[model samples]
Target: MSNLNLSFACWDYDRIQALTNGTVQAKGIDLNWLNMPVEETFWRMMRHQEFDISELSLSSYLIAKDRGYPNFTAIPVFMSRFFRHSGIYINKHSGIEEAVDLKGKRVGIPEYQLTACLWIRGILHHDYGVHPSEMNWYTGGQEAPGRVEKIKLTLPPDINIQPINDEQTLNQMLESGDIDALIAPRAPSCFLNGSPHVQRLFPDYVSVEKDYYERTGIFPIMHVVAIKDEILEEHPWVATNLYQAFVEAKQKVYDGFNQTAALKVTLPWFVSEWENTRQLMGEDFWPYGLEKNRKTLEAAVTYSYNQGMIKNRLNMEDLFAQSTLEAYTL
Candidate 1:
């Protein structure tokens, strides 16, 4: 078979790199990983007509879809979940011990409009009965500007999440007991546990989710996968192969492959780092089955619509080109 030239945006996002490993490589589809920062990656993908298969975040997906990159599809490779949101942390000495305790105090978040952060708000208001709008919020998310807007979502009408960004200021405020609690997606700095701090709040789901996750190695939700349109038209089989590779590799990780076996295919990814990253991630972190990712894509579109992130409403059938996945299923 002839080699396929595919455009994949950077490898900094851990899971994207993992997915691109043996899966895409084995199909004679070499990766053109965009080696820039996240913002630059988006712009590069936007300007370059050459992107055959790009790895993008859900927000980035919306942006690309708006700009008319007809081939963009959320592939059915569900490899992440709500773990990357605003984590809720309080000072060790601060008397505020629960999610509800931060009523009229300041909260620090990495960024605004992040999906995981949205999940955090939903959990806080819907699950824990905390009104997000009433509390003061300070954001310290990525310096890359558009990301914050994407992260600052409006929930339940009255709940308007305000944002403030400045890493040093947020850190100083949180440490000085100025911010009563910190609500943000997981950051290396705020991790009391390897996962998000709020996992402590969801007693019922955490254990059940953990047990089932350990049993099946399932990730509950995430941005799913898709092939670039031109590649789907020109080399449909390779796209299907890419999808199959992820499914197979996921099984391989769950089934227990020693260093030599995985490394031969995985190349530079150390088994320890690879294994640890998987263990540190929550069970819902990889929750996409072949058909399930389509559901995630559906949920994502619904969310983008509700959030007013996009002007055009994209149906699943319209957004995803299923020729490759359909053919593979047969």
Candidate 2:
């Protein structure tokens, strides 16, 4: 049988590098992989459907599915997972001493519906009784000006969301104390360049994240692998084939991290770090299937629904291809 030719787009993360380098390949498929920044990848996929398969923002994917707009179907392969506590930066002069202090404060965000912000907002509400409607939201680009939300949003009446002035960026606003805090996937430039005024809301973010994970078991999923629905319909087998290929690719990265002979990567404590992670997160720490990630998925769905990004709550069966939901074992 001849292999089907398909285009896939994603960032050049080490786990997915094997697929890009031809070490791991989907069975009966010839993949044209494009390594690009995540923003451009998601923008191209969401705006033009440029690729047959690509990594998409989890929040945007849920929005697309809820509205039945994009003709795409997702798999259980989560391309990105991040704990977002470290992503929140605050102005040192602001009186925001704790999560509860965010109430009535002004916060800047790159986009209101970003997955990281959604997770942070949900965490604040659940942990500190600070709801989304409690704070004023300003949205714009972090570094440059004139960024807009990728998807349309119809939020609740009480929610305060406004765009920043064209003259300023979120980072500038954060540094000037125009906004009390900022929540984003990447730290603002002011925070990155050691501006004395900008610091993480939780200075001890590592400990907070570890304790939060222990309490909730949610390592917040950020992105998911999606395929055009037409492609899935034309070749149903492509679903499981691609899923298995991604699993194999991730295993290669794991194996490299665990090699004890010499450091495979640049990190001096690579093996020790791997051992510590294994003890905390178990052997297959970064799992890619539905069952192993049910709690995480459920939390994301609830957050999206609560934040008004998705009109309805969706389940795993609704979001992922059925063929890739479970793996057979010996």
Best-fitting candidate, measured by TM-score? 2
Candidate 2, residue 120: lDDT:
92
| lDDT (10s digit) by residue, model 1, range 1-330 | 666667665535444444555442446666666555544444455445445655445555664665575446656665446542234556655567666776766776655444555445544664457766767767654222223443223345544455554335454555566666665544434344343322223335446445543553433353444466666666656656776666666655544434455453455767665466567664333544445455445555555554455566776555545654465454
Query: Where does candidate 2 clash, by residue pair?
Result: none
Alpha carbon lDDT of each predicted model: 0.53, 0.90
- Candidate 1 — which residues are off by over 4 angstroms? 10-28, 33-52, 59-71, 82-86, 92-95, 142-168, 188-220, 226-238, 257-287, 293-319, 328-330
- In angstroms, the error of model 1 at 20 is 5.7
Tens-place lDDT per residue, model 2, 255-286, is 88766888888888777878887888889989
User: With candidate 1 superimposed using the best TM-score fit, by how many Å does residue 201's alpha carbon deviate from the native?
Assistant: 6.2
lDDT of 1 at 148: 46
| lDDT, candidate 1, at 115 | 50
Winner by lDDT: 2
